[model samples]
Target chain A: MLYIKIADLKIRIENKYNYVRALCKDYIIDECEDYDISVSVSDKEIDDEISVAEVAVSRGYAEGVCVYRNICYQLPVKFNSYLLHSALIEYEGKGYAFAAKSGTGKSTHIAIWQRVFGDKVRIINGDKPIVRYLDGEFIAYGTPWCGKEGFAVNDSVPLRALCFIERSPTNSIERIPASDAVLRVFQQILTPRDAATLDALFPLLDKTLMQVPCYLLKCNMDDEAATVAYNGMNNDN
Target chain B: MKIKSGFVVREVAGQTIVVALGEATKIFNGMIRLNETGRIIWDMLSVGSEKADIVRRITEEYDIDEKTVQADVDAFINTLQGANILE
Candidate 1:
């Protein structure tokens, strides 16, 4: 059993493969008998993940995927946390998340930020980050399941805004109303398969949407895109 | 017409979102976002309301003309029907 801490929850994972352990090394903690939650995947679950995976995956990778999926599935009801499919970054001490459909250049946009802000910008989680509502603030935490870039840190940041990226020839961004943001945000979250968990998620999701500002960023791959995104979110525009 | 079973409706951020779950996933795997009027129509449909009855209810509730209400109701119902969410 490997004990790890993620999104401030202490969890015990019954891992069968070294790959999962190494993937989660940054979040590993000293052995402890007490944990907030425990997870273990059956062979069937690993097989299920492999079958649905976009590419071929080894048993170890599939095991890791199943464990993370199980953790995400439990987080909404167990803790006020859920997995968000976004590239989370910290700029000027506040977390900002760039979300879009797969192959939508979320990582590319954030990379532009890195070039513009230099060391002031840091990737919290390049792909999948856990968003937890803590004490009236929505926080973004890094996990091992970050995308192919392997950019992640064992840290958390208070999220300031979430931006949905869209490709366009012109660079523009605007603060979107909750009515417009909800469905876009919902599509990026790992929505629960059961009604009860989803019921618990709706309120948290609502609160997050109401409290945190959301933006629709229609931008091209230019240095100006990062500056425009930053200025718009900061109300400097 | 009625919404398919296993579809859960929730009001989030003052917007209505219908998500398919369990058996409903076998047909629809994504969520449907509805505006205020669409929500009203959806609620009526959940209870197996008829098309003419839904048109009447919306016209009465919103003080809208019957023709406009009928058109909106028809469009909304057509969308649901195309999505296979209405039975």
Candidate 2:
């Protein structure tokens, strides 16, 4: 049994699998005993303990390779948070996320940011990060199952911008309209198909979008692309 | 026809968004963004308002002619029907 904090939420997890435990080693905290949510992951057939949606997402996204990832998606909704399929990075002490389809080079774009900023930029999570509206601001946090690169830290940063990246001949960034931004952001999140859950989820999403500025970043895999994005977003607001 | 049971029209940052909820989300595909007039019509549709009632209300609210309001309402209703959002 281990207690850890992700997305500013305290959780205690009991796991029999070493792989799952190792994935969350960086997040383990010894000081906390009470948890808002507790998760147990095992191969044992515990029929009543699992959700149908959890099993569906396990097969759909992680392909059942990691039970832990499935839980990461499920638990956030209970706290009015959502897990987004994006690479979250901390730049200049603010959180910026890159979102796109699977093959849209989100990770590659992050690499370019690292190349440009070097020591100044830190990768919060390479893959999925949970986001929630907190105290009149949106915050992005790192989770254990970051991505294939396994780049994640148990940290939280105030979200500044969310960029939907696209490959293009020339580097450009534009502020998307709220309608367009809502659709794009909604598609990138792991949402449960339950009315009560969605009722809670949509308001959180709406507040996040209302607070955070979303951009459509069209760029290629080049160092110039990084500079272009940084300049454009900084000047946008 | 009535609007689907699980669809909610929410206004965020001055933009109106029609979102599908629960099992409706699986088949409703994506959300639709509407202008101020669209939001007004959606509100009426949700309450089982008919096409004639919508056209009458829009003509009364806006300075537009009855023919124009009817055309706009018809187009909007068609879009909702095409998306399979109306019952």
Candidate 3:
């Protein structure tokens, strides 16, 4: 059993492999007697993950994935937390999430922001981040299951903006209505498998969308793209 | 025809999203975003409303003509049928 804290929730994970522990080493704590959640995966669950994985994954990797999947599945119903598939960056003390389909250059775009803004940017989580609505505001937390780049921190920042990125020849961005943002945002979240969780998620999802400003960004791989995105999202109303 | 079981609808930020759960997930792994008219039609279908009844309800709600409403409802129903959402 590995005890870890993420998104302000202490979790106990029972795993069969050391790889799960190694992957989650950053978030691991010495011990927790009363964890908020406990997750354990069956052999069938691990095998199911292996079968559906895009590339060939080891049993250990599959186990780790299954554990995270279980965590994501329970977050919304058990807690007001949800997983978002995006590259999260903290800039000027606020978190900005860049979400897109796989291979959509979300990482590349955030890298441009890093170069353009220099030390002003920090990558919170390169791939998946746990977002929790706490104290009337959404906060993005770094998790161990970050993407291939392996960039993540066991820290969090208040979420300020959510951007849906698209590849384009010229750089452009616009603030989109929540109604327009819902479908796009849906594409970047883990849909709960059961009806009860799905039902419980709608109001939280709506509240998050209503609280956060969402943008549709079309840009090329240019430093100017980062500037445009920053200015568009950070504009003083 | 009626909407299949295990299909849930929820309104988020003024947009209606339909998602599949449980056994329905095997057939529809994605969500369907519905506009106002689509939501009306979907609600009617959920109650097992007939085609003429749906058309009448839509016509009573909107300022559109009967022929336009009929065509719109048919197109929406056909979309639902194509997605295997209605049974």
Q: Is candidate 2 or candidate 3 better by TM-score?
A: 3
**What residue pairs are clashing in model 3?**
none
In model 1, what lDDT does residue A190 have? 80
DockQ of 3: 0.81
- Chain A TM-score (model 3): 0.98
In order, the first chain's TM-score in every candidate is 0.98, 0.86, 0.98
Residue-level lDDT tens digits of model 2 in A1-237: 667777777777665545555667787777575677776645533332334434443322332234445455455467768888899999999899999988889999999999999978999999888887777778888888787787888888889998999899889999887667877887787654555656677777777777788899999998999999899789956
lDDT of 2 at A157: 88
In Å, residue B28's CA in model 2 sits off its true spot by 2.9
TM-score per prediction, in order, is 0.92, 0.76, 0.95
Task: Give candidate 3's TM-score.
Answer: 0.95
- State the displacement of the C-alpha of residue A2, model 1, in Å, after optimal TM-score superposition: 1.9
Report the alpha-carbon TM-score of model 2 versus the true structure: 0.76
After the best TM-score superposition of candidate 3, give how far the Cα of residue A72 lies from its true spot, in angstroms: 0.9
TM-score of chain A of 2: 0.86
Tens digits of per-residue lDDT for model 1 on A1-237? Answer: 899999999989999998889999999998888798899999999988899999999999999988998899899898998999999999888999999999989999999999988988999899999999988789999998999999999999999998999999999999999888988998898866888788888888898998889999999999999999999999832
Better of 1 and 2 by lDDT: 1
lDDT values for all models: 0.91, 0.78, 0.92
